[model samples]
Target: MEEKMNSGLVTSSRKKLTIVDTDVHHGYRAQSDLYPYLTKFNAERFAEWGFGGLSTHLYTSSGGLHGQRVDFDAGEAGDGLGTIGDAHYCSTRLLDANGIDLAVLTGGIAGAASALPDVDYGSALCRAFNDHSMEHWIAKDPRFRLNLDINSQDPLGAAAEIDRLGSHPAVCGVMFSCGAPKPFGQRFYHPIYEACARHGLAVTMHFGSEGEGVNPPPSAAGFPSYYIESRQLRPPAYAVHLASFIFEGVFEKFPTLKVAMVESGFAWVAPLIWKMDLDWKGLRRHTPWVKRLPSEYLVDHFRFGTQPLDEPADPEAIKHIINWIGGSRTLMFASDFPHWDADDPMMTLSDQPEDLRRRIFAENAIETYKLSLPAISQAA
Candidate 1:
């Protein structure tokens, strides 16, 4: 689908601000596109088992479109599907059309790879996906950056993958889908974080894999009957991970580490931070290693993507939330492109002050991802 923004809405001082989309999902037009990247052993194994796209089960609530925008041409379903054509179609349709300066490609490998029971197989799948993305997506467009997916089941392998690809000029960060075997801050995953810090790359945790494959149920109360219910679980899931990262002193261990919570809305963040600060005041003795209030770490080391921007009846409420969360620095723009719920850059958060809008749209992302911007023709 072609996504164009209303040019008037994005102009700041009569200049269209460059946009940095932190969470664009570049999908495989077909499963077979990855075969050439997969090892001979794994390729044969996949053939026997049948290709499992990113998720283990179909998103029953996607209403047959699987959460993709109905207008998106997924190309035909045959050999050489996405590889043959439309591979860079999204880049032209969305980024170029909308004046996006840089987009981080969060591919669909993390969930499926993390869900595999065989750790070796999961690692192999991750490697293949990274290789495929490098050749087909990042190499095709200098504007597209990568968030290399890793298999959390094998942290060593995940770290090795990061070390191997972290230096690529277009690789910006490391990504893990929300559903993992354990909380991200656990010692088991420290090596992954260590590698990210070493490479000066940020870590992005996107919402995916909940209740699918080997992931536990979507919510603590148990699985919900409808998709809306599952959607509600996303914020809390991010909250849990954030709390885990804070209380466990992950930030203290790697002070330079930056974490971006993609697709999870930011409205709930202020309240959660307030509560954490309140409890920490009384419970500081338990986790003495945490040097400051929980919220302080978040402000310094974490960023929230602004895709599912909260829409309150009063527009002022959105501004209030942004201020409470530390202004423009705490949020970054993410299109979640090609997905059914993707936000329009010109439309989402349009009411914010121009300075804040510019920061969210570009500056915050560049700083968070440590991006080196390339020259592009300015929007007239």
Candidate 2:
């Protein structure tokens, strides 16, 4: 297969602003601490079944996981360390190196780690991972932010764990998987929303999963098998979640809770949302329980990231998504940094007119994450 050609430099003279690297995989730090704890039982059992553990899949590119793959060549980007550079290539590093006011570090690998069935062993590993993150990645530097990856299989238990750590002040939200239950709905995951609501924390549903069977695996009936299936799964999942909350009354159940869909490209937002609202109006009698348009419920509850944007990169699509979601106020910018094909972030608004750029890159995150400027001001 031919390698993708990297795009030209992100051309813009616009001043940089605080950026949040919402999706990151801290590989070396994770490998050091996470590798040793995998019990021989888990490792051996996985091996017996032709299954791979964190060590095999995540640490090695030949395996399916790609944490190491993305960083494999970042060193040549001028940051020194190979693929995985020191702090600068990491989220916290970028925050200091760039004018990024805050950083939210998330894991695409840890979700898979939590899915392994060791129960006590698995959960223990989860704690170790979070503790490692808190101590090394987040605590090592003061400005970086951390969001707990709440493994979805046992959300209630996960929620309790989140509540226990909720007071940490470093963890700002819980990250749930897209299509977590095969079909999406918050009912099975209410405890998480409850805990988050009680603690005034936000909930982020990030795209991609490493086959943690908390929910049923996806089916190809209407889905594709490639990675793009993951993208296809998101809109429908969001639709189900929104429908459940509207029809099943989740927001009424918990007034303060908020959710953000991370790494879910915004291209589908317009048409999907329009279909949702239209269906709600035209098909209401089928589910009289729902009192509002799906669009209304969604605007109040969801925030979407601009990374992993769909293939076309059409400006019209972006505008449509923003308009359908109740304006540019509903979208947030994300770098998804260090990952292969990561939006250079600087390019997020480069092609757009100035006003839309400001809304997506800055304003929306402030409103959604409830971010506030640091007491010590920095260059905008």
Candidate 3:
């Protein structure tokens, strides 16, 4: 079945899926349209930061961060490694185009998700990006929602934006990238977490380059010189974010704050949380401010996306992650969609245990992102 919109468009009626993409990088694809709103500093900084052989077509000039273009054939339109162009891609090309339902819009831009300046400039750009998404991409469709990517530099500025933007009917939550110089445990991001708790907006952290704007040679770690080493570093960022919240007492401060660690593989979560619990049990004397075990804090406060699945991802492995992280409820499913690395959405879900099918596919994401179905009757 299909439903008709006020705009005279028809979309899929399937309601079992609600994709809340946490690691999107589409901003690089739309940079030309967004550049006019960026400050002169953003443009100048972007060029100055380019290293040899990495001449970029998309990036803010101020920090040479928050932007990178995707490559695709002219005929592909917004179809790149992992992007679908605009609302059409979400509704038509992918979901309706594939018999799926509901989509939560997030950025595919690196810089937008990075620790750019502070939350002030970061928040302004976020508003601009959301405005652009709603007007040009979502086209006011209630089903296609947005999440604000906040700068970790200034948590207060981020908090202010979350208060302002979270109230906007179109926004679903706030996003925090993990690679900032400030380790996640610092007090720098508390205000943003506080704001999210107040507004009831979910907080998201995606896995990727921290956009430190610096490159590391493989020899530093004695790892082989290959592009994969760069990618391996992505998952560690999540641990940093988790450690920040757990050790810093952010969760204790705002118990209701909902946080989701996206794009990072779920496999490591179980072991990491175990290690965290052990560390906290012994290290509590070191940081007397923390009132509980870090593992207990994570099980209560965090959620992880299940994608970039381990090769030979056995049912036992999936089950083990669930058990380690506390339960099946903490695992949410995602395709990572148009990115070259995205796992096949269908294959990922199909492999799950029968009892876990519904919760992982959509139910958990709805709770994590705080999105309601709009009551089918209400949609009409």
Candidate 4:
């Protein structure tokens, strides 16, 4: 268990841009690593039945294990079998290589915690994962900001968990996994949202746990048969949650609360909002609390991350999607690092204007999660 060592500085002088990767996945070698953080009762549960979620059992992985990076020296300098954890390895291989100023560590298995049948167990798992992250990853790197993993099943417990860890300096947001029993409106999960709003933490729904554990099927028509169909289903699912958050008055009640929809595509935002706005106009009385157009709420309170970004032959294609989703203000850059489909900073949107690229790559993330970092000056 030796840590790979490096300066941990981004060496931004080379790139002359402040890059913030909003969706970096940090993982544990095994559940045993988190045993110290878990309660004795739950520790036994974890030991008996590991990762009680069905998402992994269904999907086929690509690239390396779990579709992680295949080129990094995961164990030794000659290039090893893994690249998921080890903070210093990330510093040398990812941050320094790309000149990234900061990265938000979005816990990998956190989503499965939400999908578990037992609400109390799910919340406990989220808590243990949070504790494990605070020790292993956050304590290891200043560049690493964490989004606290929270179970959506136990709203009050999740809210209480947020109260416990929300004020931690390294915590910028919360990772609420998808595959929720209900689309995240319904006032059922308001306590969690309230706590996040109280602490200025963004509620980031990273795409995982689509059809897993006790959660519902990924789609209303039942589970999709193939991986490609599930990938395409991401945006529509997000659109449902987005609509739930808006129409159910989640945003109206918690005005300052922000959400980061991660790994879910952004192209559906336009059509969803258009239909929502049209329906609201004709049927505003059904939910009178929604005082404004859905798009207005989206513009003010939501941020979408770009990974597996749609790469049309030209970079210009993304701008249309960007404009449809309230401009670059709502777009945050996410690399989905260590995964096979991860986006490259220099390669994605390389042809865009410097300012726009800066916003999407760095500034939007900084704004979305309300992180306070010193201004970066470009190299002369």
Clash number for each model: 0, 2, 25, 3
Report residue 142 deviation for candidate 2 (angstroms): 2.8
Supply candidate 4's per-residue lDDT for 76.
26
lDDT of 4 by residue, 84-155 (tens): 657777766777767777889885556777788787887887888788888878887778899998888889
Q: Comparing candidate 2 with candidate 4, which one achieves the higher TM-score? A: 4
Quote model 1's TM-score: 0.91
Top-TM-score candidate index: 1
- Supply the TM-score for candidate 3: 0.78
Model 4 residue 293 CA deviation in Å: 1.1
Q: Over the stretch 104-198, how does candidate 1's per-residue lDDT look in tens digits?
A: 88755677688777778888878888898888777788788889988877889999999999998888898887887578888888999999998
Q: Which candidate leads in lDDT? A: 1
Residue pairs whose backbone atoms clash in candidate 1: none
What are the lDDT scores of the predictions, listed in order? Answer: 0.79, 0.58, 0.58, 0.77
Ranking by lDDT: 1, 4, 3, 2
- Model 2 clash pairs are 71-83, 87-93
- Give one digit per residue, the lDDT tens place, for model 2 in 1-380: 22222322212232355455555444343244444445666445433542133332221332112533353454423111112334445633445434455666655334554455544544555555576566656656555666775556666667767877876766777776554543335477688778887777787776544333443454436435565444456666555555565666677777676777776777666777778788778888987756777777777877777777664555576555556666566677776655555665655656666677767776766666665555432533
Clashing pairs in 4: 73-79, 73-80, 74-80
